[model samples]
Target: MSTSPDRVGVPASDGSDTVIDVAGLHMRYGPYEAVRGIDLHITRGEVFAFLGPNGAGKTTTAEILEGYRRRSGGQVTVLGEDPEHADASWRARIGVVLQETEPERDLTAEECLQLYAGYYPAPRDVHQTLALVGLAEQANVTATRLSGGQRRRLDVALALIGDPELLFLDEPTTGFDPSARRAAWDMVSGLRSLGVTVFLTTHYMDEAEYLADRVAVITQGRIVAEGPPGTLAGREHAPAEIAFTMPADTTVDDLPDPVRAAVAESTSGRVLVHAESTLHILGPLIRWAEGRHVDLPDLEVHRSSLEDVYLALTNPDAHTV
Candidate 1:
């Protein structure tokens, strides 16, 4: 869909409604360019994740898009307005959950949300916001008394006080335990269910896999790959890995043909199979083992995960090891 008349719409390359349109974005710190000509289009109501190693300029690009930093060059339109020039109304429409914050130590959770809600013209109910963020039980608790995860939830609740149309979550689950991280994931999923667009910067691949509709990999100030979490770097369709413990009697040299084409290795009590399709070789491997009265132990099948693809695409040199 097209944006405001003067601001031309980015033609949807992947058939998605554009919420953030950026082209040739650049940011520099003195003589050193942190971001060099990056282009990305975040679709409406979709979770877009930005992944990169340290010093890859992911943060710089995200800051420019969030209006926290000025871009040295290139076109940036967030929700159809230049983020750098957008006013309070524009700011009100966006929610941001930063990495860290030290709010007033004395304020209660309810009071905190209530205070921030006053700034927005149409804010969500404080009590409801508190419950939505799983902080209802801590409503009356002092900010300093809350745990790190609870404090992070409070940050999210404050960001949602404005009932924003777009949300920016940067390393939201940084210190969260597994359950807390799952809770945060559910909250993000809930926001998307309400049609809130999300721009996320995270190091957690599993979190990205669970929440992101699409992921972008940035390295040395450039987007090397961008697509659905599963499909990035063509890994969505990459082969699966099958591994099982073979009986002590079966040796590598005794394995059958055609099936042998998919076997990556076989030694002692273990066997590893790499195949384009799991169905093609799984049954054969089982039957072959059974026919020989081989007792297979701990059979497992694994596909190329987002983490694997991320490492492969971002640091090709490291994969050599």
Candidate 2:
């Protein structure tokens, strides 16, 4: 799909609320393919996270959407225009926060924002942008003097100065301390409240879980799973693990038949049970324990985490690609 520069503010023709659309996208370098026919979409005013390990097609796919690298084959539309041929007006409607930046050492934060604001037809107030990014107190500080977290915030301020409708954030909080990362997350959440669509790429699992409305996992140039972080790869329905300390005199063979069926691992005093329904296994085990007047010590139940699902989906044995 193609949109003219004059149609900069127009909605998509398909009547869908999508801000980004990619179908059968692929990228190639010489004979090696970096992206292999991946299809995905991002809706308006939602935070969408793209996740993958190193050497996956995450970077290639993001670069294509950002208009940095042309795809080898696919159909892509960003804000109703083909990114490869989008014009300056189309560019103005989008903002990008790269993984790192190097601003002029001598420029103050306020001065830096002012300079970038001049490039857009309508820019946000410099002071307001600084405050939004928690850099209001550091407005006069030189770029070189700012701390790592402050510099990262400045990058976000620069991206927002143009009042963009769509924001692309590539690892926005890579080196942040825990507190700083949470602060950055708040800023991204604020952007969503202002009706800005965010396309995020990050390696942090918790970050994706906290900030994304939906997540897509890509591996070897193809998407292996896509859904809400909680349910990705059917994680919500995956088995729950029940672990407890067995009594000193207890043996695996002595346990009830139902309990034995659920047992997955056992050590000297510890037993691990994998069950689809905790109540099914716990009921029988509890009855046996109560009848004997013994305690089920240190019992704990845990469902699969996003990280667990991710590792499973991206397992090296899944496919050669």
Candidate 3:
């Protein structure tokens, strides 16, 4: 979406229909460049994931979009206002969730939300927000007494009390256990029903795959890849792997010559074929295997997962241990 100078803080007539529009974004700290020439386009109500290893400029870029920090250079318009110059009304249209907020030990879950609700001019019903985050049962429970997962839900409740049009979820499930993480994923998934645009930053690849409509990966201050979770970094075009244990009484040489040619690996009585086209390579092999009356019980079909593609896109050496 292109920005119109006259409509910097409102809907535009420049044929632009995006919630966030960034072009040539850059952030500098002293002599070091953090975010460099990143371009992003996020439409309204879309769930977008920004992923990268540590110190890859994700935080800096998010802060810039949130209006907490000023960028050294770039054109950033979030919710129709340049975040750097955004006012209170613009901020009211967005919500941000950190790992956790300061403990509201003296307040109950409902009270905590009520206090935050007062901050917004047109707040959502406190009860509805509590129920939406699955915290209705804990409404009267003191914030400090809630379980870790429950506290996280309260964080989400606080963020939602304002009925924000855009939400920034920054590592919302950072330290959650497996069950807690899954529960959090479900809650985040429910946001789609609300029609609120979500900007999610997470370390879990599965979380991104399950939640994001599209994902962008950053490395060394640049966007290296961006696409749907299933096809990021050409994952959809990656070669398929056809794997199985070696058939008894059969050697690689004994297989049909066509199938043998597809064999990329054979070791420890196991064989793997990297098939550009699974059916063409697999048909000949399966026919040959069944002809010998053999079962390929351990056979598995595989593709490069999101995590695998992510690893291939970023440099491991650049991440801090």
Candidate 4:
């Protein structure tokens, strides 16, 4: 639980700005193309999230970037070296956390970390790595005795033991409860503050919204949209909706002409107005209610959420509005 700025065994900054760069990337399994000509660039010390539904080629793309799989074509540079031909030193600079791991059941948490630490020429102190991932209190607990969330934290500790410049996390909070998920998010944010570039893959839209500096959404083996979570697929520009429960004895016909013009639909005694300018519609609606000495109940304004935009981008057949 220490937020100390000093991280042991961290490599000196090499002055490289770009952490990951991919151009015209493609991957094919036999005749089926899983990834088709996608391009992305991730900067140093930034959190980048890749989102997609199952079998959307997101996993395939991530594996290629991690050097676990070979690309069919295109150029990839991770940490200023091609992952395909990078040397041991290049591998030392990158860390990968798989979706699931089965650590030795009998080994204590600290023991597991110490085991992995020996793999690197310069490894972080086992105790410090435990604290960095919020696992210091559980250091002496056996791996099998720990909870699911605790085990996930151990996975991260193992990944960080090498003091990697770049870390790849695949669904780091898969089975976590709400509180645990928030803790994991805080850990990731701490990693970013320490100048580690994170390449994240997760199906959770809210996680991407909260953690990623930029996001790329993949569907049907291609990138459909790429931008900040707030603006991806123009979610920021999508129409705003003003909704309110109709006061008793106030029929749709009783609504003012300007208010009625903005009405998109109504259901269960509630009226929804869709407009680009929410205030323009809300102002008149409020004045109309005031003149009638009636209050508009349960008034609410809403914009497209990140989940809304993500679903629309991943599923073209789905309606956005």
Candidate 5:
């Protein structure tokens, strides 16, 4: 097969064909409803990430999209066809790397890839697939003999053997070390360069931030927020946290007037200010410390991060009480 990928689907708003669309989707487990009327869209050649805590129905929703589960209600379309009714041809165009995959323990990685490749009409070269996932050296090793990171790479290689137009990755780099994780990121970047649509789920905010073009936060079986990684869940404008050690022999009462006023109004009692720029508060803090004849000690400033946004949205009930 040619290395150049065929164009898949597109987005709805831009007049391009949508790759995946879900409208008011719901899934039930007898008495309980897991997915509660959720809607989402994924465009062609884009990496869309889904973030949610355990039991928030993220996996349920993904399985429904993959045609593994029948929906209780609502509509779901993958590659412009209803996932529930799609045939084998539709399945051939999409590759899925699920969280828990157990190959025959005695089978070598190369053998496993070769076995799966036979099912596809136009699979990628086995050697190239193994190298793409950073498992080139471990091709001869049995699945039981490979390390956690190496095994994960094999899983990814199997997913790509079909040369799928769209790929689904569930926690793709969960067990990888730092270096291994970076390698996985590079591999995903290469996939994007080839114009393949990637849908992934990851708990590591940094991973999602690096890989996903757009991310959606699902909470209580609903999408609380959806946008680009930087702006999702209001992370772009969230307040920064500032902490500094008080000067030696200086009591809170001895602080400068302006500094004392600001500190007094702070509920945290540590001069926490919600400001756009840290410098804005730093200037006043430094001047006040000098006027009070006390030296500032160990100042630190940190802005809102994606982790903060995730915790805020996923655990709103914790904050509510």
Candidate 6:
């Protein structure tokens, strides 16, 4: 497949509902710089995924944005304030769910949320938040007794209890089964319609594809690509494949020149065409088959999946997080 990549994260804007505006973000541990010149603009009510391989500065950048760590140099603003210097009010407007956190083992789901709700000046209704994360049934279960997925939902409920405008979800569905994970996805998807911005980080490509409106990939401390999932790294522009089973009596020479020109292979009872222009190839092939009264019933067209594009960009050896 041909390779084409989108430009890095666009410059942060001022005249929009941009919830997170970052520019030239850099972080260093001694002389080793973990995060390079990173740039991002996450708008309000959008689910934006930050993806990268391990040791790619993903966590470092997130911490800097979350106010848990200091960047060596760069401009960062989340919720309209510099997190490094922002006050309590700034923190109150956002919520965060880390990859893993020890829950309050002694407290029931309802009690834990009730305890955290007191910390927020205007928390959402405790029961409503529980229902939102699919945890209403488990509200009376102790955190230690609840299933893994249930605890994760409780974490989400805790985060939402603050009525936060922005939520940072890091690997939110890590321990979930297929059904549980998809349920979490639905909950996160609903957050967008409620005008809550989400900054999501996940290793699962399908999760990112399903949940994010836009995504950015960071590797070796810099963004390599940024765009919508289908268009990111120009996955949408990759060559299309047109394939069909070769009729018993057919040969490549029997096909019209236009169709023949597009064929990548024709042997072993199958013909494959790499279509740079799908219509150009399809029309001629269909007409050729019609003229011969041949059935193209087995024909199919395929595009590169997001995983295919990502592997191309990161190389087969790179493991994502």
User: For residues 118-184, what per-residue lDDT tens digits would candidate 6 score against the true structure?
Assistant: 7766678898889998888888888889888888888888888878888999888876899999889
Can you give the TM-score per candidate against the true fold? 0.90, 0.88, 0.91, 0.92, 0.82, 0.89
**Where is model 5 poorest over a 10-residue stretch in terms of lDDT?**
3-12
Clashing pairs in 2: none
Clashes of 3: 0
lDDT of 2 by residue, 121-182 (tens): 77788999999999999999998899998899999999898889889998899889999999
lDDT of 5: 0.79
What's the best-to-worst order under TM-score?
A: 4, 3, 1, 6, 2, 5
RMSD of each: 5.8, 4.7, 5.5, 3.7, 4.6, 8.9
C-alpha lDDT values of all predictions: 0.83, 0.86, 0.85, 0.88, 0.79, 0.84
Better of 1 and 3 by lDDT: 3
Off by over 4 Å in 3: 1-16, 316-321
Q: Write the per-residue lDDT of candidate 5 for residues 71-149, one digit (tens) a residue.
A: 9999888887898998766777789989888766788999898888777766789999988888888888898888877
lDDT per residue for candidate 3 within 162-186, as digits (tens), equals 7788899988888899999999999
Q: Which regions of candidate 6 deviate over 4 angstroms?
A: 1-16, 316-321
Root mean square deviation (Cα) for candidate 5 = 4.6
Please give the distance, in angstroms, between residue 196's alpha carbon in candidate 6 and its true position after superposition. Answer: 0.6
What C-alpha lDDT does candidate 4 achieve relative to the native structure? Answer: 0.88
Model 2, poorest ten-residue lDDT window? 1-10
108 in model 4: Cα distance from truth in Å? 0.8
Model 5: what TM-score? Answer: 0.82
Residue 280 in candidate 1, Cα distance off native in Å: 2.7
